[model samples]
Target chain A: MTHLVVVGASLAGLRAVEAVRRDGFDGEVTLVGAEEHLPYDRPPLSKEYLAAEECPDPRYREEETFAGDLDVALLLGTPASALDTAGRTIAVGDRTLSWDGLVIATGAHARTLPGTEHLEGVHTVRTLDDAVALRAALRGGARRLTVVGAGFIGSEVGAVGRKLGLEVTILEALETPLARAVGERMGRALTHLHRRHGTEVRTGVAVEEVLSSDGRVTGVRLGDGTEVDTDVLVVGIGASPATDWLDGSGLTIDDGVVADETLAAADGVYVAGDVARWPNALFSDVAGGTMRLEHWTSAADQGGRAARHAVDPAAAKPYETVPYFWSDWYDGRVQFVGIAPEGADEQIEVVAGDDAQGGPFTAIYRAGDRIVGALAVDMPAEVMKYRRLIGGRKTWADALELAEQRRVQRAQKQAAKERGEGA
Target chain B: MRINVDWDRCTGMGMCESLAPDVFEVDDDGSLILHTEEISADQEGEVREAVAACPTEALSLDGPIDA
Candidate 1:
């Protein structure tokens, strides 16, 4: 039997084990995770889980599920300390496990602010335990909550704070929220959303220190020496790939484990999930020359794809998929399914409803005559049509017409279905 | 047919909407929203085109559409 060893018991690691079995691999698979708890979803950590709206359930397979369903061995709570790539062994604590193949799904770690140690109420959301702690803090009815970053996680948490009836103030070092990812316009849109929902979002401000007295966080001091009083401080600056274990593993570790389109690094080693920085055809203009995404669902998807290629090299292909991400904040659900690069020339082809009232709309990102990406809000049917147009690489003129045609066709289909003619 | 969305594989690159506008949509916050649970035979060509056009191979059609 092929002995496969996977490190980092995250969404990616769990899915990799499942993918191996799904791809007809009856091999001896061992999954090693750092966390003691079973693999659960992380996206909910910031939203529903943080708000106490839902408890953390086993989103992915547990030890019993893996052992019974896939017949895979799971090593929980033990992290892989070292990778002996040449020797084909992984050092976990004092014991070394041998493997015919290795999959490194060790996801990234949330970047935290210095001096945040032992400071009560200063938290970062990455793991289930972190979410549980943060949720407990919120349940205590903290007077004011200060989020240190304006990125996705911070913004989502800020939205949650407002929903929970807490005074939420966000401190962003950049001029706008999500400046690095979605440019000024979309960021401004989000800023508007936050402001409208009663969250205090301060841009161009930096967190100099997390203020505390008697090991309990009281507030944060800004770079300008202005102190904002608060009981909770959540930092969501960003993340760094969990590649410290591979210090001498001979694989290139830039921002993440450098892999090609096939997610292959060296001869017997492979990387996937947020820890692996693979070539991205969609966002090729980024400075890193590759994209390292650290989302929950995406990590699982990449893990499965990488596992398939690792099990059978003949089935390997370039990793290409339309990037899709969603966030539920306040009363509205925001979703993006395409590259909305910073400063890309965008054209508004279809606006389904009134923007002021929060309705469906589609904005097409265009570079010359070619449609590079699409942004949709509320208009699910129109967004669906635009998704197809983007994939087909259709021209602007053709895409517009198709969008109109699709609207009409969908209405007809819905009417037909309602009349019991299309069911 | 089960429509599979590899969320990690997706870069929020909206191609699915273009090919089968009747089936796939992007939500307000920029995630793929599926309009139909199952696709029809007539929509298969466009669906395939959308899937193939996915820069990340995030979209997949499993089994038969009628199934």
Candidate 2:
């Protein structure tokens, strides 16, 4: 039997293992995870898991799934220390394990504030322990919270803080929150929801330093020399792919483990999820190079594709996906499809419904005449519609027309819902 | 090639329309409207890609590619 070894007990790792079996590979599979607990969902750590009234286990699969449902071995809590490609083996602490095929799904880790590493009440959420600890801190009455980034993770954390009734303030270094992902115009629209939910949205600024007293973080100083007092600090700066273990393994590593269009890293080794950085022909056209997306859907899709490639290299196909992600803040929801305008050539802002507060709108990014990206606020169905357009290689004119149609339809639906409630 | 949609499975994500607007369109009310069921030689590649991109597994191709 061809034994396949997968590193990182993550969504990608789990999905890949499941995919190979589903495709009838019948190969021996072993999953090596760094975390002590079983694989669990990560997105909910910032939303549902963080905001839950009662804390619950976030395991992606139950005990039975590993024991009986799947034909796989689980090595939890220990990380692969090194990879020896020539010998086809990986070092997990003291023991050396051999494999016929290897998968590098060692995803990224949450970045930390420069000076707050050792300080109390400072956290970077990437694992179950981090989420559980953060939830405990909130439940333990830590107030006047401050978040250092306004990107997806930071914004979601800020919203969760507000839900817990913490005085939350989010600081973004860019001109707008999610400016790099959605563009300035639409990113500005997202700020409206934060204000309505009692979270301070401060843009065009950055967290300069974490204020500490007696080894506990008390506040943060912004780039403008303004100080904001806080009892808890959440650093949502960004992430770097965990490719350090492959140091002497000779795999090309730039921002991530460089992979080919087929998600192949080497002759017999493959990579997937946030760690696999490869050129996406569709989105990379205007952006100019490869990109690594760190969304849940990307992990799931690429995991299956990578596993398929691993099982039968001869039948491998280039991995191409229309990236999608959804976020929630209070009563509002934001969904993004394809790359944002920043990744494309030109940005075309479109509004369909009279939302009165910039809550409902669609902005499409165009590279020449082709629709390259889109951002939809409180409009998921439209995001899906735009995804089809982007995949279809439709023109900007078509996107604008479709946005107008969605806007009018959404407005009518909202009015009808209101009328129904009144009656 | 011919295209068949499992209407029950289609979430109306409309990624198909995004792939080949000439072939597919998902309206605002979350309904799918296929422009045509027949896939031309030129559109076979994109049409196949759209089927793969469908998140809900609602799309499938019935015949061999003319290309």
Please provide, for model 2 over A159-274, each residue's C-alpha lDDT reduced to its tens digit, 9 standing for 90 to 100.
Answer: 98998889999988887777677776667777887887889988888777888999998998888898999988888889999999999998899989998889988877889898
RMSD of each candidate relative to the true structure: 5.7, 5.8
Instruction: Name the runs in model 2 displaced over 4 angstroms.
Output: A343-346, A354-356, A411-423, B1-67
- Interface quality of candidate 1 as DockQ: 0.20
Q: Could you tell me which 10 consecutive residues in candidate 1 chain A have the lowest summed lDDT?
A: A350-359
Local accuracy of candidate 1 as per-residue lDDT tens digits, A1-423: 388888888778877887788667987888898988777767768887777665747355555788798888878887899988788899998889998878899998889888785688889999888888999998787978989888888888998898899999989999978745655655666677787888888999978877889999998888899999998889889888999989998889999999988788876677888898888764453323777776554576688877777777677888855555666677665656556655653444433444443334555665556565655555443544554455555677887676677567767766877889645
Interface RMSD, candidates in the order listed? 8.0, 5.1
- Report the Cα lDDT for residue B67, model 1: 19
> Candidate 1's residue-wise lDDT over B1-67, tens digit each?
5678888656454556655768776543457778886767778877865665554457888985431
Off by over 4 Å in 1: A53-56, A282-288, A345-361, A380-384, A403-423, B1-67
What is the Å distance of residue A418 in model 1 from its true position?
Answer: 16
lDDT of 1 at A315: 71
